[model samples]
Target: MMRTRFAPSPNGPLHLGHAYAALVAHDTARARGGSFALRIEDIDGERSRAELVEEFLLDLQWLGLEWDGAPIFQSHRLPGYAAAGERLKAMDVLYPCNCTRAEIAAAATKFGPDGPVYPGTCRNRHVDPTGAAWRLDTGRAMALTGPLEWVDEIAGRRDATPMIFGDVVLLRKDLPASYHLAATLDDAADGVTLVTRGMDLFPASHIHRLLQALLDLPVPTWLHHPLLVEPDGRKLAKRRGSPSLGDCRRAGEDGRAIATALREGRFPAGISLSQGIHQTP
Candidate 1:
């Protein structure tokens, strides 16, 4: 059976953008007689909040989105992430790096899809592994996997060029796993067949494809849908302080109606949809 998921972090309240993504995942799975699962991406110890998980669940329910099975929480899967990191370490494709953001920003000369491309400063250095991040050796990883490709429902077939992001982090100094590692592993563990998310994350699939090949995980098809944006074309985000669904619910607004309107390309004034440009993290 085809499976899709809407994994949301519990660092903030759900906004209309979250609503759109959830509805797309839910409706697509239901339409094909498949399953839609919800995964709470609450692994960020510094930012993730236990209370917000319940709030987001309430918002999802209010929006008439029902996920199959009990929700998966990343916090409970730390050991699995650690094991995956160890597997990569065993492959000799991971190296410890202690570069600070300031150090990287000052030293990096080229920018990749996710930000300043890592200069491989620690690739050859004897940095202390303590309190250091684990970075994937993208060049070596690609050489081992050879040329690869993944298909997106909207973007068509594309080559997997993980090098664009340089040697991306697989494990962070403070977090058990980076977004790329954890999300890929979680999807495979959940038997998810279709990865539905916003177009802004389209570039991430390249790195994910590499990880899947390295870990010998099942590859899933993807749908990078358009994003809900403001009138000025800024993608709605929690950091931008987008209005929360809780606010709408408290005002007695109809959640389903809002979802229907969104499906029909009808958004509130100053809110629009866009195929957002590829972003830098």
Candidate 2:
């Protein structure tokens, strides 16, 4: 059975951009007669909110999307990440970094997709276990399942590779799994086969692919859809104060208008009468 997920960070509400991602995953799963699911990706402990998580679920349900299984939340799975990190550490693939955010910024000038991209500060430095974020050692690079070519039924085949995303973070100092580590682990654990998300995350795919290879997990087929950009071409972001799905629902918008707005982008995807989510028991 094909499986896919709509994992959203609960740090913020489901904006229009997220709605597109949900629609793509929801439609594709139904089209292929596969299972659709949801995963709460709250790897960052600082910003996650339970209310926003509720909003994400309500919004997806309102949009007529369905899930195949119980929602898998990352915060509750810290043990799995710790286990995977232990494996990589056993192989000397990880090292603790004592460098602070400021120090890393000073060492690295050019920034990659996720900014500064870490200078691998403690990749070779001996740091006390009491402090600092851990970094993955990439000196011994591992290859992926394939050359990373995947077809997005909408956008065609992509040839993106991992070089752009250098040594990634597997575990944070405070003991949280980085997005890469948590997402890869959850995808495999949940049996996901197709991953449809915004193109903004295309660069991160390489990082995720690397984790998948190391953990001996199946790398899912990817469909990197174009992001829902503002009129100025800037991609939507939760921090940008973009309206949330909860906002639409409160205004009493129906599902059809919300979906059309999501697809066309002519206007915001407000809630519609026909497409709103019916509460499930």
lDDT of 2 by residue, 75-128 (tens): 888888889988988877778777777887788866777778676666766787
For 1-281, candidate 1 gives per-residue lDDT tens digits of 99999999988888999999999999999999999999999999879999988888888888888998899999999999999999999999999999989999999988987789999999988989989999999999998999999988877888887888999999998888999999999999999999999988889999999999999999999999999999888889899899999999989999889889988989989999896556322
Q: Which window of 10 residues has the lowest lDDT sum in candidate 1?
A: 272-281
- Assess every candidate by TM-score: 0.97, 0.86
List the candidate 2 regions with Cα displacement exceeding 4 Å: 143-161, 264-266, 269-281
lDDT of each: 0.92, 0.73
Best by lDDT: 1
